[model samples]
Target chain A: MAKRPLILVTNDDGITAPGIRTLISIMNTIGDVVVVAPDSPQSAMGHAITINAILHVEKVTIDDGPQTEYSCSGTPADCVKLGVREILDRKPDLCVSGINHGSNSSVNVIYSGTMSAALEAGIESIPAIGFSLLDYNWNANFEHCKSFVKTIAENVIKNGLPKDVVLNVNIPNITKNEIKGIKVCRQARANWEEKFDKRTNPMGRDYFWLTGEFVNMDKGEDTDEYALANHYISVVPVQFDLTAHHAIQQLNTWEFNS
Target chain B: MAKRPLILVTNDDGITAPGIRTLISIMNTIGDVVVVAPDSPQSAMGHAITINAILHVEKVTIDDGPQTEYSCSGTPADCVKLGVREILDRKPDLCVSGINHGSNSSVNVIYSGTMSAALEAGIESIPAIGFSLLDYNWNANFEHCKSFVKTIAENVIKNGLPKDVVLNVNIPNITKNEIKGIKVCRQARANWEEKFDKRTNPMGRDYFWLTGEFVNMDKGEDTDEYALANHYISVVPVQFDLTAHHAIQQLNTWEFNS
Candidate 1:
């Protein structure tokens, strides 16, 4: 008999969110499952880790499943660190994060707690992926996501991802029959056109709320935005090595010594 | 005489840290400066923005300086957003973040608040640069850094940075004469090997403190780690585009319709 691969599951929407619950159920059928996730919602936390504070991890049973779960008091990146360093007996065969409630496509990848967990795992040389749905509702239909999610995970387990890379998989908000398939794409050049809502509190002090509209500036058909818009599940291979290597030569041309 | 260029100065070590104070003094000599930075230390905050809470910015005078300052109650990225949207009268010609008290070389850039501020600016289409000193002390020597810092800033002002790119500059901890000049380099592949210091609290609950030893796995001579080790200030052009473009073709070959 072949040994069952160990799979570590986690998410940004807390341990008990529907997104992670759906993810845990899918992972259980494929391999030995262990979940170490944030105890509270950590959306948009980026790659933050708790350095100045003490971290706590508590064991708990959320539902009847073969998976073992631990609730962590930290960010998504911290959860991966603790899971790998403190909880897991050995290195897992695969690490999967999310089924996130909202989209992590395009520029949102830079601000996503879900993607941060996958990146943290990738940094540790673990095969990893981060999944998200276009819908932001708590009860967003994940029934249609099961087959696609399992296929992607199984493929990753069968074939290792590229070095220093992880997958950002975003499913469009649609019926199962509507999803054409998965398409590998690039991150679009985009940003939030920020608009601060200014208001006064009862104490007579001004406060502001950070709000924005996502503006996609790239018109290329080979982008994640284009893939998602065309009803295909977008799979953008993401890397943590941020160096713009091509720009180094141009920068070297600048004089630094006075 | 050409009008003095407007410069936005910020840091992750709080508004009153010696790092920002030194940065402000240098900017004052180069241009008209406006400082918008965190009210408290926001080290290792990554690219987090304050979305679930109200943000506050208070104007103040920290010392007898030519630059105007504001203390923001938010992360480094949040400060950049607020500075651009609500605080500044117009778009500044240049945005500079940090004389950060520690190195932001190699993979540390993924977890750095200082670099996040610079990235935020780059996304806004403003030429941005993040500066760091290898010394982590509150009072690291800036006397030797003044000339080099000024030269870099002047060159950036003269020639704009590439699209979707920002400069990450790390100065080595050495005397002025010992410095070997500057080098344009790529980010080295390095990561921290985390160790959790487990302890029992007053309630007898287990808690952990995140600690680690940095491990540099890449031996490339053109990397920022190598340049800094050789006593040269390393400048790596960093881009916020997270896509692993080279891996996209390989991923496209995956069978997803199973």
Candidate 2:
């Protein structure tokens, strides 16, 4: 018999979140599974690592499953690092993050701890994917996403991703039958127009809650936003090489004499 | 005389760091300055926002200067959002983050609080730059960086960056006369080889410190790592559009039938 592929599973919604529980089950069917994820919710953490403090990890059995799980006191990115470096004796064949409780589409990718975990794995030269649903509810229907997730993950392991590339997969909050097939897309041009909710504490100290309106400025139909709106799962191949190579020549034209 | 441009200065090293103070001094010479940075050090914060908790901003004077300063209880990205939406009456002519205590070159750009601020500004369509010195000391000499910082800021104000692009500038720790000129470069292919220092706490629980060896895998002469090592200030224009456009066609061949 062929050796079972080793799979590392993680999410930003914490180790016990239903989203990851579903992901763990899906991975167990495909390969040997090991989960290393944050002990508490770490949404919107981006690519942060725990440098200022020590991180604690506890091995636990959350459910009756073939997969072994470890809860971590660190950001999503840190979980991937610890899993790859400390927990596993060898590099996992693949790393999958999320079934995130909400969308990591468009500019949201910049604020996504879910995607950050996958990006961290990608930086370590592992084929990785971050899966998210358009729904924000914890009990949102991840059952509908099971087959699609498995197929994508299986394909990634078989064909392999481009070097330094990871997948940002966002499924629309729709039933499996209602969903159209997956579409390869680009990230949409979008931003948050911040609206601070200012208030004074009883002790008279002023504070503000960070809230914002997401404004999508792109009209391109090939974007992740467009795919999601059309009820198709969007798979944007994401890269960590942030260099805007096209802009270099123009920047070079500018005078920088000191 | 025409109105002097409004310049927003910030950093991950906190409001009292010598790095931002030097940045503020340089911006003061070029335009009207406003410093809105984190109240405490927030290095490696990435693109995190304070959505889970309240944020506080206090207007104050750290030193005798014409520039207005505000200390913010948030990440470097939060400082930029608050500065643009609540503090500044108008969009800043240019937003500059850091003269960071350490390098944000190569793959460090993904985990940099300094670059996150600059990227936040870029998302808002504000021309932005994040500056860093290679030294990691709190008292790293920044005098040698003044002229280069000023030159870059002036050029950015004159030649607006491409849409969705921000500058990641990393300066080598050398005297002005010893330094070579600036180089427009690409982000080097590199990553941390994590060495988790596992230990037992006083309470007898195992914890780990996230430490690493930075290994540069790219041999490209045009990379930021190459430029920095050669005593040149490295300026890599970075984009928040994480889409690996080149790989989109390849991903389209994936089987993701619903």
Candidate 3:
């Protein structure tokens, strides 16, 4: 028998999110799937790895599927660590994270629990990808994402992802038919124009809730933001290293003592 | 009166740690310092922020210094968010994070709370930096870091950090005199080989404590890893965008069928 591709599956929206279920269904069609993910929501956790506490992962049967699954008591990155280092008998052929319920484009990638899981796998030298939809709603339509997800996954399985690089795929929230072709792009020059909602607590103490308006500063039509707006599925290959190579030379020109 | 440079101070080791205390002491000499830091340790948190929970900022007196310090219940990113959004009366002239108890060079930058705080500030278009020492011990030597820290801070103040970039400065564990000059470098291509120590609880439940070995894959001497190894302070300018621009063109070559 031909060896089936062993695909490791995980997400930030927890084990029960429809997004992962959609991701799982796609993986099953392509490979022998093993799923490990957070049992509860871990959105916006970025790259948090559980170090201050102990992590517990218990096998759970969520759907009637051929895939073996485990639910973890940690962040999304924690699930990737548990999946590769403990759960899987050997390194999987590929690791795919998130048909995430929200966008991981532009600066959102830094705060994405979805991409963090994928970056964790990339750090472990595994080919990895993170998939997200521009929609943030839990009930956002994911059926349209199936083909793109499969196509991307198959491509990764066929042509290995670059070392230390992971894919950040953000699908436009429109219907599958309305979606244009996929566009490989760069992250947008964007940021949240944060407006803190200050309120008084029950104890009459001031507190704040993080709220913001999405501000796209880049007018370039080449970025992920532009691609998504043009209705294309934006695929940005992201690496874990946060270094700004250009600025290093600028720092070098400065005399530290002067 | 000459305007005092507005220095925003933060750290991943929490506002109370000696590392930040030492940093605060030094910043008092150069500028008007205002600290917005986490009340508890946020080590290894990466770029995580408080989204689901309400954020509370409580002003506290750590020690008598020129800086006014406030402790907040959030991750390192949140500290920067609060610092820029609410704490500071105006945009900071420069933002500085850490003097963290350990290294945040190479692959650690991706998983570092200290560096993430700096990156957060950079994202907000603020001149920013993150500093750390080679020692992970709580009582790690800070005396040696003085000259390097002062120099880097002064350089940033004088020349202003470039757009969309922050600096990750790693000092050797040796005394300030034994420390060689600073080197502007790239993040070493490296990662932690995760070794989870799985154990059974008293209830016979399985739990894992994340552990790892720092593995360097990049052989280039132009990296933070190599510079730190050679007893020089490594300054790796960092940014939030993780997009691999070189790989974008490569992934575009992949045939994706609808």
Candidate 4:
């Protein structure tokens, strides 16, 4: 029999979140799992890393499982860096993040700690994937998406991801039977229209709560937003090479010397 | 007389950092400046937005400048969000983040709070640019790049940026006379080879301080890394779309079932 793949599992929702626990259990059925995740919730951390502070990592067993787990006092991106460098004996065959509590579709990917972990792994030349459920509830049902998750992971392991690329998979908050298979899509053109809720504390200083409404401006059927809206598991092949190649030519045309 | 443009200035390196002070002075030469930046150093914050905590914004007078300034207890991205949504009376004509104390070239762009502020503005359909110097010191001399910075900002204001794109500009830590002209380049293919400095804490627990050496793997002359190494100011057009469009067709061929 072939040796099982070594899977480095992580998430932005912290080590104890149900999202990662479900991801761990599923990976166990397919590979040797080692989880190095954040010690506390790091939602929407983007690709932030702890550069100014020291990081504390401790081994913990949240539940009875075969997977080895270590929680780090850092962001999701820091967890991946530590996992790949300090914790793991060798490079992982696959690094999977999330099973995130909410969607990382379209513009949300830029703000996602879940996707950032996966992107960090990809930058290290590791084939990685970040998974997110459309549901935001802590007790959201993940049972319906297990088979689909397993299938996607299996496929990724069998056929390695392209260089500089990682997968951003967002599942609709629908039953397993309702999922219309998977769709390979691009990120939609979207943004959050920020609305700050200003209030004064007892100290008489005004503070603002970050609040926003996500607005999808793209009507493209080939976008992840379209796929998820149609009850399909959207798989957007995400890249960290943020260079806008097409814009480069146009930028070159402008004379810098006045 | 044409109304002077309104330019929103911000940075990852706290409100009083010399980088932003230099940036403010340059913008003041070209437009009406409003400075909304973090109260403390927020380097390497990536695209993080303060969602879990309440943000405090206070009016500050860092120096005897004509610019209106506000310091916020949030990440660089949060400063831009708050600036546009809550602080500014109207959408500014342009947004500029950083004359950063360090380089955000190559893959470093993903880990940069300076660039994140610019990207956040781009998402809001505002023309934006992130400027970084090759030096890392708090008092790094930004004087040498003043003319270049002015030229670039003026060019950006004259020729509005493409929709959904921002500029990542890096200047070499060399004298003005030695500096080559600006070059529009792609993001280099490179990443940090992370080395976590493991140390035993006073409490007898192991802790780590993240350290890394940047490894440039790209040989392309059109890359930002190449431009900077050759003493040229590098400008890479960056987009937040994140989609790997080239990989989509290949991913579509994968079997999602069985």
- Across A118-223, the per-residue lDDT of candidate 1 in tens digits comes to 9999999999999999998888889899999999999999988999999999999999999999898999999999999999999999888999999999999999
Best by DockQ: 4
Better of 3 and 4 by DockQ: 4
Per-residue lDDT tens digits for candidate 3, residues A144-199, read: 99999999999998999877789999999899899889998899989988888999
Residue pairs clashing in model 2 are none
Taken over the whole model, the C-alpha lDDT of each candidate is: 0.93, 0.94, 0.89, 0.94
Error of 3 at B215 (Å): 1.2
Worst 10 residues of 1 chain B by lDDT: B249-258
TM-score of each: 0.98, 0.99, 0.98, 0.99
* Model 2 spans with C-alpha error above 4 angstroms: none
lDDT of 2 by residue, B163-205 (tens): 8899999999998998889999999999999999999999999
Candidate 3 or 2, higher lDDT: 2
Candidates ranked by lDDT? 4, 2, 1, 3
Who is ahead in DockQ, 2 or 3?
A: 2
Better of 1 and 4 by DockQ: 4
Q: Which ten residues in a row have the lowest lDDT in candidate 4 chain A?
A: A249-258
Q: State each candidate's chain A TM-score.
A: 0.99, 0.98, 0.97, 0.98
List the lowest-lDDT window of 10 residues for candidate 2 chain B. Answer: B249-258
Better by TM-score, candidate 3 or 1: 1
